[model samples]
Target: MKILTLHGINLNMFGKRDPKQYGTATLAQIDDQLRALGQELGAEVECFQTNFEGEMAERIHRAHTDGTDAVIINAGAWTHYSYGLRDALAILKCPIIEVHMSNIHAREAFRHVSVIAEIARGQIAGFGVDSYLLGLRAAVSAVQQG
Candidate 1:
């Protein structure tokens, strides 16, 4: 299966960002973990990170054309707002799994809402890098059972 993993907005700064919340894992580390887990799950994982909203939306559009079987997204701050990304994800026929290293619901009020939730098949959060790993597994499972 083909899985697209999206890291958005300021997520590129994961390691340098709030270590208290995001932990010390760099974005590259997170991607490496996803790829490794994907391999074990028999899925090909492609990860994309972008600070630009339009670029992310465009990437999601491409995923639609690429016939991606599933998408695992940790859309950073975009998770709370980015309707553009949500709309792009809506175009896909495959499963969408939203993930967060932190527990968004337990964070600030502004961070509590996920615009992507309604359209997503499921959500996994609060497990640091494990969230991405779990998301990948969820994506693979969703594709298999779908």
Candidate 2:
């Protein structure tokens, strides 16, 4: 199975941004962990990170034609208001799993809302990097079940 992982905006600063919520794992390290877990899950994981909203939307467009079986996304602040990204994801026929390192609901009031949640197959959060892994597993399971 082919799985695409999308990391958005400011997430490139995973390690240096804020150790309190994001932890010390660099984006590269997080990608490595996802790839390793994907291998064990018998899925090929392709990761993409972009600080630009247009680029992310474009990538989602590509995933539509790329035959991606599932998608795991952590869209950072964009998760709250990026209708463009959500619309792009809506074009996909595969399962979409949203993830967050921190519990967005437990954070600021603005962070409590997710525009992507309505379109996503499900969501995982509050367990740091484990959220990504769980999201991946959820995506794979959803694909298999279908």
C-alpha RMSD of each candidate structure in angstroms: 0.7, 0.6
For model 1, the stretches where C-alpha displacement exceeds 4 angstroms are: none
lDDT of 2 by residue, 91-120 (tens): 899999999999999999999999999989
As a whole number from 0 to 100, the lDDT of residue 27 in candidate 1 is 94
Q: How much is 38 displaced in model 2, in angstroms? A: 0.6
Runs with alpha carbons beyond 4 Å of true place in candidate 2: none
TM-score of model 2 (CA atoms): 0.98
TM-score of each: 0.98, 0.98
Question: What's the CA error at residue 99 for candidate 1, in Å?
Answer: 0.2
For model 2, the local distance difference test gives 0.95
Best candidate according to TM-score: 2
Q: What is the lDDT of residue 15 in candidate 2?
A: 93
The prediction achieving the highest lDDT against the true structure is 2
lDDT of 1 at 6: 92
Residue range with the least summed lDDT across 10 consecutive positions in model 2: 82-91
lDDT of 2 at 128: 92
